[model samples]
Target: MAKITGETRLENVLVYMANMGRELIVADRCTVWLIDEAKQEVYTTVAHGVREIRIPAGTGLVGHAIASGEPIIIEDAYLDPRHNPDNDRKTGYVSKSIITIPFRNNDGTVIGAYQAINKMTETAKFTSKDMELLSLAASYAGKSLESVMLHQEIVDTQREIIATMGEIGEMRSKETGNHVKRVAEYSYVLALALGLSPKEAELLRTVSPMHDIGKVGIPDAVLNKPGKLTDEEYEIIKSHTRIGRQLLKGSRRELLRAASIVAEQHHEKWDGGGYPNGLKGEEIHVYGRITAVADVFDALSAERVYKAAWPLERIERLFREERGKHFDPAVVDAFFAKLPQLLDIRERLTDKG
Candidate 1:
């Protein structure tokens, strides 16, 4: 039940299955290999004493099991020419008794294989009971792996859509090319420097691209204006924040929720002077506060239709000056802390004409 329930991450699932198979069959080592059909390769990350190994599909004993869709037990692996001894040669571990069991998805299509090396029992060879236990474990693992892989696919697709939507908004405002990309990278570094977990920082990077997604609704005249705007026109410009939040706030998805907070509050100032909600200090969501610094730094440092890119020194000075009054102090400190990384991101993703 634990193998098939409550685990969603592919890496975690692989570890669980590998550990269970090794303990149940009393083997020295166990490896769970997943077939990457697109690359025609099989890879394993949960192999004992191994970093990560990838080999051509059907290249070794494990691959043969996956390719032939059958289980095989070897009393002496060295006697079998089908066994790949390269890993053993590299790691100085000799293989003797082994069992390989192929696993399948709901459609009965072979998707992966489990290989356990060197039975730990006194016989030093796998018996019928060991084979049956491994086969049953493989069967139970198949559906759970498929479900987790499908969930990952959906998540990747959603993130792509969100990123493309961000690019579309940038295109609409004539701020075309790499601006959102720079901001996303910048936001990620800032999030990490501020002590967010790697997962949380990665989530911020994925959603930060959509920070300006509301700009899609602003009129062309206001969005593309190349001169100082009239007060009324400036107010119209500020409405993009609200427009962006409105577009994403309806979604209950976690990514969208974070994007909505960023869209709505990225313009808010630290001292209760910013527009829309005028949220002050920590009152604003950390995502929004982090993005505000990222978005502004990119906007100021990147060339725009209305203005040439400001020099790096000037931009840095402004950030220093605005540390507490216009921006979160901790976020600003993070920007300086990760300045080298942020500069590298800006250079790599620099806009091209």
Candidate 2:
């Protein structure tokens, strides 16, 4: 119960509750079905040993429990008219005994159902006692699911806002939204190739799009200038990193903090020749180093207001030439290792005229 309620991710919460439901009911398998009220669908992802499934809100025994707000215990599932044997046919798992209990939020609204199949005991039947225990578990799971769903919604909204803000920054400098999308995907692939965990890699993907967010503060004249800039104008351009950092650094949220670091240090060179702070390799945050490679690659490959796009061969040659001088050697190696995925991203999100 502690672990189930503590989980902030909806998927994790569903898996934990499903495992708990199987144990509580002493069944061979359990599935936690969630109601997508807006879509009028009931879906289950952690269906124990079977493939995930989704159906209309009132389609099967589980859906009937949800709609009728009743707990059902059937000794022979095949004999029950409401039973949907299609899943059993698909998986080749015969179902004998079953228990489906509706779960509710604090308001007592039926949110979903818990279905436990094939009791493990000698009778091959779920008793009244089993239904009682499962009902108790379902009640707790309902509240937890509600909280986790809310958390997921908030996180998704935050990601959308960040991406939109990043796009605004890019658009100010005449770059397309696809530039940030490509960079985000490229950063994710590079992070994984460099041996970062999936969670860390996903974080990089979400925040790397903001690497040029500081450009939002740069004057349009200098930002869009086709001609080479004077030293003073160049200095002003360089300050975008600091400006971006300043805009995001104060946030207490981890997402924004990660974005702050990427915004400030994406231009920093491996040899300390780059950027607002000139922090060198290893000293620079990995997020910054990773974004630096992604940002530069996209900038060079895509057509921009000031310059034409470079050919793939020329861009590859520059990466090889720069090596440790311009980018962390490890990140650059990872970049090359995942070049195919990066190219696919470019193709998919390639700026549409």
Candidate 3:
């Protein structure tokens, strides 16, 4: 389960399963092939040192095992009629003993196949014990795969919700969806470079877009003013910080709670000149600091109702000059360090409208 949830990528989960299968079964190599019934294909996500592979369902020993929902063991793979030597030929691997097991879901539907090849033994033949271990592991893999998929679906749904809400916040203020997109990208890179785990980085990326969620609470007169805001209107607009926090409060979901922190503190400055509580330096939450840099960068890059987009030269010089003044010095460094990726994200998610 740690292996499954620890990974953000599905292929990485399959890679973990295959590597564990090979080690547990004492085989030279292993492959984890997930079935796509609609496509009638068995796609290999990971194979011992190989990149990937795919074949039609019921094509080889592994495929047949999956199609029939059965397990197969071969003392000599080359002698087995169902064995497919094409993979070995391509990978320059010699076929020997093999075992293929079908991984069935809770409903007893075969979802995938696990194959271990060339058992490492004096006789180079797989033992019954080897088959049993692999079978048990394959079953666990199937259940873990199910859990991982469900987790992925939940995460995707959460992302969709955050994106939609962020878009609403931006659109209400006359900003484009690309504004939120750039913020997420910039936050994502800063998070990773700051040494957060992949899972944490991904979470920060998803929720960072919600930094301006409180904007939805600001009156359109203050939020969408084409001209400079009056002093009264400025104070009213700044209340978006507390408003966003209140809007996102009380959610048990980690994403929402994290988003609340960003929304509440994204306006805070490192020098204690920022609004809300005026959290300064490390006094501000790291999430807030990271999102602040991302928010400011993207805001300056894009044209806004308040002002035109700043020239890149001015933006870069300001980042350098404002280090530790407006933005966190470390975060600024990470921003420049990952500037290329940040630029790529800007280009990739450029606003069409």
Candidate 4:
């Protein structure tokens, strides 16, 4: 499946469900809840006029339907035992009439619930026409949400696979740690700071780990040498940049294509002094430039077999010292500008190994 764009897809789905529910039924409040099967809960805020609220199956009007696999229409919420006024009190909404439906798939399995409360007509009681409109909307909501959720699941699966592959590469080189995760997050921050769009930034976050993927191709003797490598071994190590690019090259996927560029150019110095290609300054792609700063910063701050983590001051000094030569000056500035966030990420993702 193709990847979905932006962080707003889920949010947009919820908002649209809520809006449609309100417009079609002319209800004062419409609440859409996506089920959490493991937890046996349906929860949401989406035009519910409250902070996130979660209810268990068989608890309220909506909950009862979710549990019983049926729908309910109550002319007066207070008159019905199945109706729960707790949500009304919590949201400062007075629900007089309500229509709650269980959103089911083709096999009639309940995946979600939709409720429209307080019909706008002075009569207030929900009519047959109202129920018809609502049931149709509920059906559409279930199908629409299913599509969005599937897209989300696919995106999550792809990221996990990428993470596993990155870990394998790091493990092969004996640099076992949370290096990939940290670098991905750091690259995202740098990408955003460099003014890349959110979609591009997220793509960078997912694929940045592959920057060192070529290490898997290196021999153990050279990869895990205890000290400085001999000139030949060092040259061999430098070839990893080209190797990584070639490994990721020819992918039709955008994630792999961006990764290919980063893999090849991350080692290139801004001053035309790096290995493999010696690409200079702006000649290097922004993905490479952003990944370079993140890789170097994390590699320095992180613990290594041959060296311990650098002091924070030393790390700061190096960013300042290498601003234009080893790193792109603007990217370095962005790194320091967002240092607090970076430090927080490092703390949260600290290597347990």
Tell me the whole-model lDDT of each prediction, alpha carbons only: 0.90, 0.90, 0.88, 0.84
When sorted by lDDT, best at the front, the candidate numbers are 1, 2, 3, 4
TM-score of each: 0.91, 0.93, 0.86, 0.86
**Residue range with the least summed lDDT across 10 consecutive positions in model 3:** 1-10
Compared with the true structure, what per-residue lDDT tens digits does model 2 show for residues 1-353?
Answer: 89996788888998899999998878999998878888899988679887779888898898898999999888898899998889888889998888999988878898788999999988888998898899889988898888888888888987998899999998999888898999999999999999999999999999988888899889999998999999999999999999999989888877899999999999999999998988998989999999999999999998887789999999899999988998999999998888988898899999887
Give the top-scoring candidate (TM-score): 2
lDDT of 1: 0.90
Clashes of each: 0, 0, 0, 0
lDDT minimum window of 10 residues, candidate 2? 43-52
Pick the winner on lDDT between candidates 1 and 4: 1
For model 3, how does the per-residue alpha-carbon lDDT over 1-353 read when each residue is reduced to its tens digit?
A: 46864675666788889888889978899989888778888988788877778888889898889888889998888888998889889989897888999997777788898989888878888888988998988888888787777777787898899999999999999888889888998898999999999889988999998999899889888888899788999999999999999999999988999999999999899999998998899999899999998998888888877798888889999999989988899999999999989989988988775
Please give the RMSD of candidate 2 to the true structure. 2.0
After superposition, the stretches of candidate 1 with alpha carbons farther than 4 Å from their true spots are: 1-4, 86-93
296 Cα displacement, candidate 1 (Å): 1.0
Model 4 ranges with Cα > 4 A deviation: 1-8, 45-47, 67-70, 89-92, 105-109
lDDT of 4 by residue, 1-353 (tens): 11212323767777777888888888888888767778877777475667788888568887787887777888888988877788678767778888888887656678878888889888877888888887887786676677677777877887787778788889987775488889999999999999999989999999898888898889989988879999999998998998998888997867779878988999999999986799999999999999999999889998776788999999999989998999999999999999999999999999876
